[model samples]
Target: MTIASTLRLSLYGVALSAISTLGLIGCSNSSTDTAATTENSSAADAEKPAKSIAITQIVEHPSLDDMRRGIIDELADNGYVEGQNLTVNFQSAQGNTATAGQIAKQFAGDNPDAIVAISTPSAQSIVAATTTIPIIYTAVSDPLGAKLINEDGKPFQSNLTGLSSQLPLEPQLDLLQQIKPEMKTIGYVYSPGEANSVSLRDSLKQALPARDLTLLDIPANRPTDIGMATRSLQGRADIIYTSFDNNVASAFEAMTQAANELKLPIVASDEFSVKRGAAAALGVNDYDFGRTTGKMVYRVLNGEAINNIEPAVMNDLTLYISPKHAKTQGVSLPAELLKNGINVDEQAQSTDNK
Candidate 1:
């Protein structure tokens, strides 16, 4: 009786052991399948290439820097994150035309997915360097004037598109008149090599005469030459006016210093310069301008045809005035000017003589 009961119990134990072994084997196969699926999924993800963008600018000024920042941030927000799924290679020309030209060639050689040129000179250089690389330019006041656009009023077929910050000269000129009603001559400081500045200079030449004002052309080849260029206008011109010249704006503190010493008022076409110490500034918002260009870059990178994208023109205007600078520059601010002004206190604080 004991042998029979013991055999039954032993057989029952063996059955339970077999069931447990089968369950373990089934669980092992399930786990292995799950790990293999995960590995395959990760491998597929790794096969995807990260988007690449290269940004080149004429100089490292606040406005241009703001534009760069806006582009990078907007790209990240849209989906192309730096070091994550996107790569951004940024280079600054440091206010040198030759250097800008060199940078453009280098970028052309590397041949990134897309190129962003920040200013007029930068855009022109890149344009001359490559015809196949997709390009987006910002802060260029007049793309048409710069010859970046074709006769048909569009970006060259498929290669280029960007934002043009072409501001109206009338408001800026009228504002100058309001500041100095007796202003007979305007000292124009700019770099002739820059297409944007040259366009602005030509505009001023035509507009100033109609307003009974004279244009005194003062050329600055580089940022270091701005102080002298500005000082030269002191006695020859009644008031100083500046174009959105990258060189002049990069060395704007020097321009402000010379104007302060000469007791001459300066009104700038670039609103960034006003925040940097010009008595008044009226132009496009540089940061937003960059963001706009960035969205276009996203489109080109996402397989959208570049030619289909229309070149952007920024007609929005912003006015910035520093009361302290206005008084120092011997400029009287009109009530209407103040009402439309955007106080850039932080930018002004950085512009102090330091």
Candidate 2:
């Protein structure tokens, strides 16, 4: 071979060796960067602590049940999905106030990220049990009178914040008046021990007189007594009126049965009650009330201070009428009110079958 050809071949060999060495170094750097990124991701996942919350309700009524469902569904929508990054513990007091108190103590001992109390009795129990655990209560009426907050509805110096179902009494009365035109006595069936029920009853006493009507107060301490309490109002009361009481709500079927037997119409303060069997309701939807509560909980989970959130009252009212229930109770719905009603349930199942 020529000498010039041999020199060129040697130069080509050196260039190929340098290119192979650069390729190997690039692969090593890429692999190291990938491994470091994986490690960093793992460390970040490990540093994130799992969030948890406990929910307690006073009873298993449909209204309260819908509230619970709304809360869970809303939380899932906010990215705190259950069984993923969030842990939700739920307990129902089963219409027993003593059980509610015990459940509150148990949750307080667990010291979860938050405690959601539904209904006034459940909220009061949790409030008495813990002063530090953040509590977001729903379906409570008259939070100010219940001492959950000040008159201004601020959770100042307290870890209490929630949505109130405190419906306006006068509007509800006006709805009854519009239905019966001659309703002289407004009969109320509720549990006397419930703070919300008692508050509502007191408010009704003042509001009833303005419409030239009297208030008949019937007390049912437990679910079993609902029928008897409602029966007591049969002859004396011109019509039946129900407040948002957990105990009475648990056995609302009994109230419906009593009303049916007496052929007396019922007007409830909660839309769910109307859907269940009451003749009508001019009130708040407890599920929406709970969604508002879940939003508050999401804010707290996102590190917003609980004390900074002022207590809220539901402003929107939904008018629901049940033509089926009205017919069963010997009442006729006003066409004008029916036109404005958000919905009319004509096929609601009877309380006996439910």
The number of the candidate with the highest lDDT is 2
- Residues 1-354, model 1: lDDT tens digits: 211121111111212222122111101111256888656544543444578889998888888899899888666655566786778889998888899999999999999999999888899999999999999888888788888997676886369988776666777777677777788998988898888788888888888777888899988887899999899886788888886788888899999999988878888766678877888776667787677777778778767788877775665556677777888877667776666576666455667845
Query: How accurate locally, in lDDT, is each candidate?
Result: 0.76, 0.77
For residue 278, what is the lDDT in candidate 1? 85
Compose the digit string of candidate 2's lDDT tens values, residues 1-354.
211122112111212222122111101111256878656544443344568999999988888999888887666556566785689999999988899999999999999989999888899899999999899998887788778888655663478888876665656777788778887888888898898888888888887776788989988888999999889886798898887888878899999999999988998867778877888887777777677678778777757788877676664667778878888998888886677664556334344457
* Per-model tally of clashing residue pairs: 0, 0
TM-score of model 1 (CA atoms): 0.82
Backbone clash total for model 1 is: 0
